[model samples]
Target: MKFLAILILLLNILSAQNNIGIDSLQNNTGIKNNLSELRTELDDIFNDPNFSNAFWGVSIQSLKTGETFYKLNPDKLFKPASLIKLFTSSNALLLLGSRYQYRTEFFIDGNISNGILNGNLFIIGSGDPTIMIEDTFEHWLDSLNHKGIFSIKGNIIIDDRNFRQDKYGAGWLAEYMEDWFAPTTGAFCLNKNAIEIKIEPTKIHQSAQISFNTEFIENYEVINHVITSTKNSAVEVKINRIGNNIIDLIGKIPVTTEPYSVYIPVNNASQYFLNSFYEFLLDEGVEITGNAVKLDEYDKNYDFNNTIPLFTHKSEQLTKIVSEINKKSDNLLAEQLLKTIGFEIYGYGSTSNGIKAVKELKQGMGINPNNFIMADGSGLSSYNLLTPKQVVNLLAYMYRSSEFDSFYKSLAIAGYDGTLLDRMKGTKAENNFRGKSSFLENTRGLAGYIKSADGEPLALALIVNNFLVPSQLANYIQDKVCNRLANFTRN
Candidate 1:
């Protein structure tokens, strides 16, 4: 009787195994069918009449199974615009580590006797771009006051040898110089290398009152020709920076218009830093007997390494800095980070060296070198190109990296914050998709990670170029595709 029971149990076990096999086969087939439908739907959307002249490159793959769900010219290269921040931020975080911090130091070349310094004060910059007027300058001045350094008998010197002097990136347009987004970069950067101008109308026919931040008042010359017109008139303002420090504001603002503000990029970032800091010292009652000087202009061969620093200002961690770069899409911060990486890896802070470091990083990440061209740290350059598959591959690789937490948290979540704050709302993809948004004239891109309804994580890259229609139409199509992916399930 015991032998009979054992045989019966074996027969039941065989039946259960057969049932599980059938169910697995059915589930696999269902997944295949759903993927096919997804492809067809995406094809229809890409083929819409509005995008007839546009070049679309898309790649979507499962992060869990490494399966490609869809591809359209996945190997074709397209200008990634600001989406290139994904690569820039990732490379920086991995190589520099999330805990890395930039140090800007102050040194004295001579001895201090009594309450006066007998030598020059040197400020050596390490490319901390987030330094603001009140936050940094005020604190440093207080330190000087507390230390009883009331007078300096020598000049204020700027030691900016940490990075190359090239302020603008390669391939940047000359027209973008006046815009805040195209600010010049340098080791000694101040106020993001730009100044904010606010315009308010005092009367219907009077020149608009133009005001700016006090830190730059002595550094720039403004020619305001704005006229306050009728309440119903359209607001048209044109800001142009002619020559080095002269800003021309020409336009008309309606009486009923709200206060208008614009940020204009500053020329000669190093000089701006020098003049601003010099004035701050004077205002704080610290007398300077000599003029402010740039070390490169005065003595190019000065050795900054031998001097002991008086005080050092350290930047926030790389994690927080990377968050600012990716989330806000800050071009200046991105460029600064690239140069910093170059300095750390190649012993130089030039853009060329930075590009070399980026190339090396891509090789380490197992990405093909021939797949993309990286011309600048920020995607503002038209020369930058990336393939959709390469972007998706990068996303997948980062997902498995130990640095994934910092990198992931830096991305803007759909409908939540950063550039993606207003995107993909009121849908399953809202708050579920974490990605970077890119935009340039006639170009748009979205790249990052999302999860399917079945809880399958996916990495996707969608890029559109040469589109003649309004950019909103392209956004519509991208949003639709994300919604479809979010609602997809194989059960």
Candidate 2:
């Protein structure tokens, strides 16, 4: 009887093991079927007639399971546009740390006596791009007043040698050279090196009032051709810059239209910096006995080792600046950061050195150099080329980095803030999807992170190039992809 009972017990145990195996197999099959469905839907979406002629380079990977969910020409090179800012921001975070600060120092070649400076005031720029007329210059004037030095007897020299004098990115369109988005970069930068032009319609058949946003004086000449039209007329305005600071306003504005503003790139950022500071100094009752001159034009030179330090200005931390680059797509700031990385790593603040620094950082992250070509830190350059797979791979790598929190938070959140504020609204992707958006004439890209319905983290890169369709159509496709991914579940 005991042997028979033991035999039955062994058989029961074997039966239970077989049943467990069957259940596990069934679950695996279900998962495969679900993934297959996901792929089919995505394929149909991308195969839409509107995108039939466009190239869609897409890559999506599971951050939790290390699984590639989908890929469409993932290894093909495409113009990443502003999406290149992702790489630039990541390189900065790794090389400079999130807490890194840019410092601009004030030095003197002479002594201060009887409320007067008897020598030149040398301002050395360490590529602090965020200096503002109100925030930085005002405080500086106050500090000068506190020190009892209200008058200067020597020249105000700008030592702008920290960065190369490359004003424009290579491969930028010639037509956009004077646009606000194409502002020149220099070691000594203020107010992003751009000026805002505010236009308001007065009366019908009258000229529109064009004014500068900042109170500081500028030399740009505006030949106003824009006329106020009927109250119901559509607002049509055009701006043209010719012969160094001459701007032509050629269009019409309706009398009922609200104030319209556009930002224009300054002619000379270094000179503009000086002009702004000079205006501020004069406004604060400070007397100057010498002209403001850049070091390149100044005939006299002084040894840096013998100069006495006066005051120093520090910028917001790197993380805040990175937020400006990715979220707001600030081209000038991005360029400044690229040059800064070069200065910090290679002892020169040139675009070439910055590219080298980024390449080195990418290699450290195990990204293949052959997969992409980086022309500039800001995606404003059409010379930048990247593969979707490589971008997603980079995102995955960042996800595992210690600075992931800072990097992730820098991206624009869909329907909430930054560049993606109006996109993906009223969908599952809203507030869940975070990414960086880029647009050139014919290119659109979105790259960043999202969490699936099952709570699985994902990194995605979707780039559309060579499309003749309107940009809204391209945006629709990208937003749809985000919504689909945001609702994806493997459970």
Candidate 3:
């Protein structure tokens, strides 16, 4: 009787194990079907007539299960534009932690005896891109005043040796300099290496009143040819920067129109920063006997034993800075961060060094180095080539990293904030998608994460190039794909 009872128990245990295996198989099959449906929907979207002649690359994967739900030419290269910021930003977070802060130090080369004996006031820049002239300089002046120094007996020397001499990225077109987005780079950047010009209409037939955002207005020569017209007249303004510091304003503006403003890139970022600092010192009642000059070459044997440390200005944390880069797609800031990463890792700041560091970071993340080419950190270069699979891979890797939260929050959220403020509103993607948007002449891309109906997270990369359709149409297609992903469910 005992032997028969044991045999029955063994049979029952085997039956339970078999049933569990069957249930697991059924769940896997259901997931597969759901993924297939998602792929079909996305394929239909890609097949639309508008994108039929365009080059499309897309990849989507479930972050929860590590399953690829959809792919179309996932390994093909395409221009990623600002979507390259994802790599720059993510690699930055890994190399320099979220708490990292850029420090700009002030040092005096000579001794100070009763605020009279001084040689050169050195401002060593650590590439703080967000340094505001008004606020930052004011703080520095206050610190100097507190130190009982009213007059400087030396020149203001700008030490920007941390970065190389190249002020622009590779593959940048000269015509692009006219736009505010293409500001020159510098170790010590002020106001994003650009200044704002405000033009207001005056009396009829009279030239418009021109004003500047900075007090150093004398730095630039503006030839105004604008005239005020009737209230109903068409307002047309043409701003042309003829040369380095010469700007011509030619157009007509209605008297009733509000003041029109435009931002122009500074020809010499280092000089502009120095000039602005000089103006601020004068405003703060600090007198300098010598002119501001750049330290182009420094003797290697120079001793700093007698130099006095005044004060250091710490910039906003990297977390906030990265948010600005990704949200607004700040090109100049992104480039600066790239050089900074290179400087931090290889002891020198240059575009090549930065790209090398980025490659190293990618390899460290277990991504194949040859899969992508990053010519510039901001993707402003046409030479930048990346595959959808590579982008999704980065997203997935960052999703599991410790710095994921910081990197994720830095992305633009649909219908909420950042570059996506006006996109995907009132749809399934609203407030459900967080990603970066990219746009060039004939290219558009959207890559990031979306939460599905079942609360499953999905990593996605959608890139379209050489599209003859309107930009809005491209954005619409990308939005539809995101919406479908957001509504995806396994029933």
Ten residues in a row with the worst lDDT in model 1?
20-29
Candidate 3 structure quality by residue, lDDT tens digits, 1-491: 98897677567544533443243111232333377776876788789786788999999999999888899999999999999999999999999999999999888877777865377788888878998877877778888877777788888878877887455578877778667888777687888888888889899999889888788753678888999999999988877878766888788989999999878887777778888898788777778898788776444445657688877889999999999999999998899999899999998888788889999888866678887889888988988999999999999999999999999999999989989998777667878899999998899999999998789999999999998756776777787788677767886
The CA lDDT at 76 in model 1 is 95
Candidate 2: residue pairs that collide: none
| Model 2 lDDT per residue over 1-491, tens place | 98897677567544533443243111232233267888997898789786788899999999998899999999999999999899889889988999999989888878889999998888888888899887888888888877778999988888888788566889898887668888888787888888878889999999999888566536878788989999888988887879776888889999999998877787677778887787678778888888888877875455688789998878899999999999999888888899999999998898889999888778766678866799988988888998998899889889999889899999999989999988777667789898899999889999999987788899999999998766766777787778777767777
Candidate 2 local lDDT, residue 354: 91
Per-residue lDDT, model 3, residue 256, is 93
In candidate 3, residue 255 scores what lDDT?
96
Q: What TM-score does candidate 2 reach?
A: 0.90
- Model 3: lowest-lDDT 10 consecutive positions: 24-33
